[model samples]
Target: MSGAYLEMRNITKTFYGVKALDDVNLSIKKNEIHALVGENGAGKSTLMNILSGVYPYGTYSGKIILDGQECIFKDIKDSERHGIAIIHQELALIPYLSIAENIFLGNEQASKGIIDWNKTILKADKILEKVGLREASDILVTNISVGKQQLVEIAKALAKEAKLIIFDEPTAALNEEESDNLLNLLLTLQESGVTSILISHKLNEVENVADSITILRDGKTIETLEKDVDDISEGRIIKGMVGRDIVDRYPKRDIDIGDIVFEVKDWTVCHPLQDDREIIKNVSFNLRRGEILGFAGLMGAGRTELAMSIFGKSYGSNISGHIYKAGKEIHLNNTTEAINNGIAYLTEDRKNYGLILINDIKDNITLTKLDKVAKKNIIDHNKEYVVAEEYRKKMNIKSSSVNQTVASLSGGNQQKVVLSKWIFAQPDILILDEPTRGIDVGAKYEIYTIMNKLVAEGKSIILISSELPELLGMCDRIYILNEGEIIEEVDRSRATQEYIMGCIMEHSKEGKK
Candidate 1:
């Protein structure tokens, strides 16, 4: 309160009579990178939404003080007018629009009611250059990589001359290199006199970049730590966020790996759009019964491509692969075929591909296999409700009821619903792609425990993740993939982050030759 740039005092919000944020207080200094850390549903996003004016002044009770001036933001535009901006996890740019147009979409550079194309492109180019993006302003946003698109979002925020920018899960979709680059850009922006509020589950990034950190649990503030004045270790932040010390980040499980139960042989997939470009190059791997076999690779290394193509030909065209279950060859031409053959693939981008966000939890849970809750070829709503209710309890999904819309749940709860749907399908082999991405530490542990339970029941899993530590800790064996090829394999005891990175770097360098 002394001289903070922004002060949110006694902020409170409720949904359907349930408190989402209660008497939350946050103080962010000028030109500083402040981090908001919390478990899922801990009111971090809610508070940001209010600050960004997604929740209007009348909806939430609060005192928003900006530089000693009290203010009320009626909407997003109002907040933007006050030099506050928010870049959501999912970029808001239009796919078909050019980068320049998307940057100045609402806040356009115009003369006499007409958009000045030349001015727009020039301004956008400068902003993009400031953010260290090399792409041309006229290029379509969809044509660029996801990392570049993230930079475009920052440029958009800068276009409004945002003094305080909020990033919600900014690096959730980025790989290690891209994440590092973004963090560096944040530091550069700090030097240029812009304050940033980063909401992320990645504690390492918080520990590295944040000047101050605030921890929220449930709907209230737990504590705030100043990096220079307090012990701001990741463990300390995690303890505050979860309200307890987590001795083990990854739960240790006994390895009881059995014989190979699922196999993919000579899998080759060409790019779906570019017929001559190969995406997967004769990748061969196997998953043993009761084993968690991991695929570790950098972004665009074809791990997701291999998993999707084997699961159902979901990712590539002109796919050639041999998949075997119990030594018997299985031809899976579509997702239905894969599911019927006891295989399920959980997509990495769950918000876009997995659950129907508009649907209720009950509907989403039984969507995979309606026959289980059907009679005489007709879906029994009562039976489906009972089945969904049981899984909700089993999965420990947090919601008001099974009738609650999946969109209303937090990221972690939505993931649980996706798992529930697949678990209800009773697939023997589950291919999880970036399963723990964008979720908090507590939710991650719960999912890890569930994975162990699945393997103990003799089910096999193919884990494709960018996190080498997760792979080393959970998988029985790890495969290093680089540029669509399996470069090396390491057993659990032999796996190390440095070794995996070395393998990828070696193969990548040779490929460039």
Candidate 2:
């Protein structure tokens, strides 16, 4: 703790009688990677938010000492001006803008109200090169992959000349390749004297990069371990985060693969906007009635697009696909038809596309199939409440009441609500797109258990996941997609990390030719 760059003493924050951070004290050395590890509600983000001025000076009780001086930030701009830049889990990129434009968006390189495009691009190029994204500065933000978007976010911080950069789950959406690139960039930044405070759930990544680790639980500081600590294993980190040893990170479930229940054939989907560009090319697969069929792919490999295109052509146009349910052909021209034909897609993006944040849990749960709770176009509040309560209990949605707004819940609870909404629709074929993205380990285990139960109940599931481990752990069979095509289909017993990645690399190389 000698010559620490930042220190928080007796930090305390509360919201509506709930303590977010209680007398938390932490210190970070200059040009060091400090990891903040905790469960979803463990107040890690709250503390970081306070430090970054999201909670502001008066809202939270804390004394933030930066570089041996007292600091009080009233807003985000104040924090940025103090060389503290935070890249949130949810990115704030404008899709229509170019990468250079987004990088220097608010703080443009301008003189007398005139933007210097040449200087802006040049500066953006320097930052992008620093982040190992030299070729992406000219591309539109929408044209890039999610992983590249994250690097762009870092570039934005670099353009601001930020010293104490905070990354909140920066690698949550990135694939292995992209995640490695970002981590290596962080290391490079550290070598060049950039201090980073990383908030992440991936303990392996944390252990790999962090110079020190701080664990928080129940709004209290648990312990801090230096990089040289002999007992700083992932298990120890999890114990500190959850306050208990997770005997099995993934729950035990007996696999029971039954007969085929859902099947797709000759599926070829073109890009929704560009007619000549194909996103899902002639992909064919089958899902057993009592099995989880995992779709594994790298980013931009068409996993989510294929699922969305199949779940009522939501992703692509000029689509030529045939879907069958229980050995009978079905037509799903829209989401309503897909639902009516016993197919439901739980979107990967819960906040933007899945849940109505302004609505209460009761309203969101019954949104998809309101016909069941309506009489002569008049809604039955009692029935809707009953339905919401049943699904809430079934999914273990942690909410005070059904009347609680969806926005107020944590990430894990919001995910549960999204699942509940689809589950109450009584779909026989459930297409789950990254269902466990950005949730905690405890909540992930619960979701895995829920999937097991659903399969046991003779419901077929199509799980699309970027994390290969998740697909390998949960699916009975996996389709390794690459460039909108099914390159390899392997049974769970046969699929390996090496095999999946090898297939993708091969496919990508062939596509290049």
What is the alpha-carbon lDDT of model 1 when measured against the actual structure? 0.92
* Global local distance difference test of model 2: 0.88
User: TM-score for every candidate vs. truth?
Assistant: 0.98, 0.95
What digit string (tens of lDDT, one per residue) describes model 1 on residues 329-399? 99999999999999999999888999999999999999999988999989999999999999899988988
Model 2 steric clash pairs: none
Task: Report lDDT (Cα) of residue 183, candidate 2.
Answer: 92
Q: Model 2, residue 435: what's the lDDT?
A: 91
Once superposed on the true structure, which residue ranges of model 1 sit more than 4 Å away at CA? none
> What is the C-alpha lDDT profile of model 2 across 348-430, one tens digit per residue?
88999999999999999999999999999899999999999998888888667888899877788899998898888999989
